[model samples]
Target: MSERRVLGGNQHALPASIFADDMSYVALGHLHLAQKVAKKEHVRYSGSPIPLSMSERNYPHQILAVEFDGSNIKAIEEIIIPRCVDMLKVPTKPASLDEVLATLKALPDDELPREQQPFLEVHVLLDKPQALLREKVLQALEGKSVRLAKITPHYSQREQQDSLQHRRLSEVSPQQVFALSWNKKFDGEPTEAIAEAFETLLTQVEEQE
Candidate 1:
């Protein structure tokens, strides 16, 4: 029988042998956190040169500079790149989209990453985003190295509503109601066989107790 394994890190996963090679250099993608994967000296991931999400706000974005000699690793260097995306989560009030665009446009050309330089991704978080503001942001970043990955609005409000609803439902103490709500709100109903299997497993656990 063949066995399967799962690898987890930085949102992108691949087979164990993906990097097992004699190549002069291995450049990995899908990870915002850039680092060398093996002690082989040439295998490295050039993390996103710019901040793509709020989780990476503190991480210093950089690129990898490597020298290869025909299937052999020579030297590896990391070049610090400029910030192209401004991932800010602020209230949508008062801060119009034009204001945000102006702020970005006003940034010195040196501050903005060049289009031919490298790949860049940016995410802007807002409490409540306006349609006009979003349009402006898109227009400003068009053709630039910067691209908006997400624009979340009213995040706190949605979380609060869900929390309140869950708490209220839990207080009723109705098993059937809870089951229905859980299936409806979170996970949908399982197939008849799957549900029966789970119930049997639960009964066995209770009997053991």
Candidate 2:
């Protein structure tokens, strides 16, 4: 039982008493992190045995072994599962593309089996788009003991706003597109009357289609 959200909806925890007092054990699922319900020793979640996503790389995976003595639990043991492959996030903190490339180049050069290679995630801080970014990153990662996972690029708030200004025509709403044209031609926002007329015409056009 968990007092956690489900599918974005709030959910109240099930009463631990829902399990009969004499029941020796209760196993549950649907949660990614292993936990004991209401701190009850007999209730448990085993969680996932392997990393389901890079975000879950740090979750402790385990299998619970239970011993029963005439229908009552005599012992419960947690057996930790060993990690099969490593997950590496380069430049753990977001950094410029150059710094990310440098870190990738410095990764270990061991010639391990393909299945043994660690999974690599590149974290980049972007101020502006750079040409040949994928190619440059790939070249830097050559011979590294890792399998390239994906590149994650993020921008500062100011830069993100500036980038949004150049979004494609289809990505902008009709009103926003009209506002852009109006400003370019008149260097000011459209007057209320003009904006109302435009919206009326836009509605009529939409109805026709």
Model 2 error, position 50 (Å): 1.2
Q: Give the clashing pairs for model 2.
A: none
Off by over 4 Å in 2: 1-17, 129-132, 160-209
Tens-place lDDT digits, model 2, residues 50-116 = 7665655555678889899998999999998999899877776778988898888888789999999
TM-score, prediction 2: 0.66
Candidate 2: residue 194 lDDT (0-100): 78
> Which candidate number maximizes lDDT?
2
Model 2 whole-model lDDT (C-alpha atoms): 0.74
Model 2: lowest-lDDT 10 consecutive positions:
2-11
Error of 1 at 180 (Å): 24
Cα lDDT, all candidates: 0.51, 0.74
**Which regions of candidate 1 are displaced past 4 Å?**
1-13, 38-40, 84-209
Per-residue lDDT tens digits for candidate 1, residues 125-168, read 34543556567666775555444555433223344345446576
Worst lDDT run of 10 residues, candidate 1, spans 1-10
